[model samples]
Target: MKKLVLWMVMAPVTGLCLSFMYSPSAVNHPSSKTGKLIISFRNSVDALPLELNKTYINSLQEPFKVTRLKYYISHIELDNTSAVITPDANYFLVNEEAPVSKTITVPFPAGSYHRITFLLGVDSLRNVSGAQSGALDPLNGMFWTWNSGYIMAKLEGRSPASSLPLQQFEFHIGGFQGRDNVLKKISLAFPGGKPFVLKAGKTLTIDINANIQKWFQGPRSISIATHPSCTTPGSLAKQIADNYAEMFSIVSVTD
Candidate 1:
């Protein structure tokens, strides 16, 4: 059997100290009064939850089954009416097949935040930095090579629309330089523009839905019959990035 290795780096490992930053105009609260923020990623098709190996129809009306799906999320930020709060930079790999990898929890200062923003891919600095341990470890199979950098996001599955042997479609999106850069910054406002307060010593849960159907449409329409493979970064990769950049939306917030 072929080994299935999903791409993208993991989040901060256990025991890493997470620091919170407050804007200059914001009040500095005691570190002891911090709360916890739990961000959850829910992957789905147009109207159904995504399941591995289950056939689903895309915007192009193509039937496909995803065997693996993985992506990186980084540089998370939270914004309130008064100021913007940022957590220490961390790269997280959200894998569809791994439930534990889909949720991220970090300590955050208590505040009423109405907006959240984050990068859809690894930063340029981390791309060029020499091999590191933990999530960024090259052994994870997300890194392409020393020159090509990491694979920001990856999707692999079978589709009857594909022309390749075995009717397989693969998209490994990555690039950190010049015109090929696929890094995208995504910002989403809380539903109804209402802020959710996180009380000290308490936890606030934010559910985010990622619609896979958005990958096939948006700024561009991609058909597996025409373009089934995107192993390297270029214009097509950028288009796909733009499409998936709109895939994330806030679903619900609980405090």
Candidate 2:
């Protein structure tokens, strides 16, 4: 009787240990295990980098004052030689401030990815998908309550061409219908699959350059004098947002 009881107890314990060791969640494969990646937001205006530290604050150009800069990024897709890893509910918000930064844990199948593609702004589906938490939390201050959707992009600052009072430029770009709809897709290729590697406890870093010229590319230049605030989804907002989306480029990647 004593032997039988010991055996019964040991049986489940042994099985549990084996299950943990061989479980899919515990398995670490290049194509199975998930690796972490960090995404950072960099601010630039009129061809100069924006640093929140007081030292470089004075370096900003005359017409390019960096007041507020924010955007939404989600639906991460990683393309490797064998498969494409698309994680569900992957969303992130990028903002600028003192030591401003947002890090995302991009879980991939421990394999090397040759290229990556993502959306610059929230998709129309998730835009109107209603309340969410974490990166999608409305309380994070990224959503527009009056508009009933997310603010696709935000560029705020005071320029000489701007008007009085706030004397700033607020271009909030967002639209889910018609030609005014503006959601851009950005893709970057990693050759030789070098920067896409993942080792235990290692992290990959990618720096993307947001070119200021891209903001003026589509319809017309952002004349703060004429269009100062994007109270809603208007013409100037759409044009500037469209132009700015094209400026996204991968500057550097390190593992």
Name the runs in model 1 displaced over 4 angstroms.
Answer: 1-30, 80-89
Q: Any runs in candidate 2 off by more than 4 Å, and if so which? A: 1-32, 52-62, 80-89, 98-100, 191-195, 199-201, 217-219
Give the alpha carbon lDDT tens digit for every residue of 1-255 in model 1: 123222112223222323223224333443766787789999999779999999999989999999999998887777722112332236788989889989987667788888888888889888887866556777767899745598888888999999999999998889989999999988888888788898888888889999988888879998999999998989998899889888998889898
- TM-score for each prediction? 0.83, 0.73
Steric collisions counted per model: 0, 2
Alpha-carbon deviation at 56 in model 1, angstroms:
0.6
CA lDDT of each candidate? 0.82, 0.64
RMSD of 1: 14.4
